[model samples]
Target: MQVFTQDDVLRFIYNEVDAKEKKSIEDALRLNPSLLTLYTELKEVVAKLGNAKMEPDNSTIDLIMAHSAASKMETSH
Candidate 1:
């Protein structure tokens, strides 16, 4: 099995890579003890990023619409 780098783990989490590559990396993770430490760190980073909330789901669309409308109105005026 091949070893995974942090970039590989991140890409996997973000779905940047396809399922086939993901499975290969996962298999490597399961078989390699040394990969565990790097995997743990990557997992932490992924968790932190996941926890990030730049804006609430409901308000984001509303905010965008409001801003877009306002910009249009300003342009017309």
Candidate 2:
């Protein structure tokens, strides 16, 4: 009857929990609808994040560089 938090679910998702906690979360996931729902949503988010591109695209980098160059010009004047 231990209540699990979102952090616990996240830890479970990332396999950061110990064996005992993992078992507890698995049991809770089966018996608790809300916890299961949270787990499912978090799992999807984790998957999406895992597949997400971590780097900014070329255009974005160019824009940032342009902005920085403009700032430097203004400061020099």
Candidate 1: pairs in clash: none
Q: Please, what is the whole-model Cα lDDT of each candidate in the order they appear?
A: 0.81, 0.93
Please provide TM-scores, in order, for all candidate models, with all chains considered together. 0.59, 0.64
Residues 1-77 of candidate 2 have per-residue lDDT tens digits of 99999999988999999999999999999999999999999899889888766787899999999999999999999
lDDT of residue 31 for candidate 2: 100
In terms of lDDT, the best-performing candidate is 2
TM-score result, candidate 2: 0.64
Error of 2 at 49 (Å): 1.4
Error of 1 at 56 (Å): 7.9
Clashing pairs in 2: none
